[model samples]
Target: MTRAFLGLGSNLGDRMGYLKDAVAAMDDCVAVSGIYETDPVGGPDQGRYLNVVAELDTSRSARDLLELCQMLEAAAERVRDVRWGPRTLDVDVLWVDGETVDEPDLVVPHPRMFERAFVMVPLGELAPDLAEGWSDPANGDCRRLGDWDELVPPASEGIS
Candidate 1:
């Protein structure tokens, strides 16, 4: 199985539920990190986001995982009318093991993953070894939410 990283966020509606349900829907392939509440980084005015990073153990190829991410987003009623707009849920493929894929529809390593605090914090918690190379001057702004430990689910509840 290939280990892949996914970033998830929801700023609209019951954010926690949107996140939990999205993970629950992908029963076989995904495991969530501790959730964090983060300030908005870009785009127009919007609410703060509840974010999490997930590690997926799957035999699915990169393209297949991309499709699954999109399906989960759509299932949560995400719309593309606005870029960086608020949504029910946002699922991004952050990394795919050692592979690097750059395409019009998707970019593995998530193009901007290194720069986003929301993506980095929970990711760091789940994979400290992988997080090592990622922590640099460029990622200085990333901050850990104080209640992070409290939000992490028990290991028996999900893979982490």
Candidate 2:
């Protein structure tokens, strides 16, 4: 199985709820970083986002992972009305087994993972070795809210 790093964020209805649901829907979640709250970086003005990074051991391809991300986002009622617009959920396939991917619909190592504090901070928590030496883009302020277990509810308490 490939160890894929996924970046998750929510700013719309039940922000934490969306995140918890996404996690529970995953195949095998090995670890989850603490939650970080940050301001939106681009697109139209929007609410602050609750963000976290999850490491998954999965038997899925990059394309499959991308599809899963979209599925989870759709489950959260995500809309693409505007670029980087507000949404109930945002799931990004940051990296897959440290492999680089270049495709029309997806990009590995996330084209801008290093540029966003929201992604870097939580990611650093779960994989410090991977996060090292990367400069923060300073696009927006990112601060830790709490651990995933402490911030988000267990699946039993969330959606079925």
Winning candidate number (TM-score)? 2
Cand. 2 TM to true fold: 0.93
Off by over 4 Å in 2: 157-160
Q: What digit string (tens of lDDT, one per residue) describes model 1 on residues 1-160?
A: 8888888999999887788777877655455677677777778899988888888887777788789889999989888888988889999888888788888998887888778778877888878776787654444443445443366454467655
lDDT of 1: 0.78
- Segments of candidate 1 deviating more than 4 angstroms: 136-160
TM-score of each: 0.84, 0.93
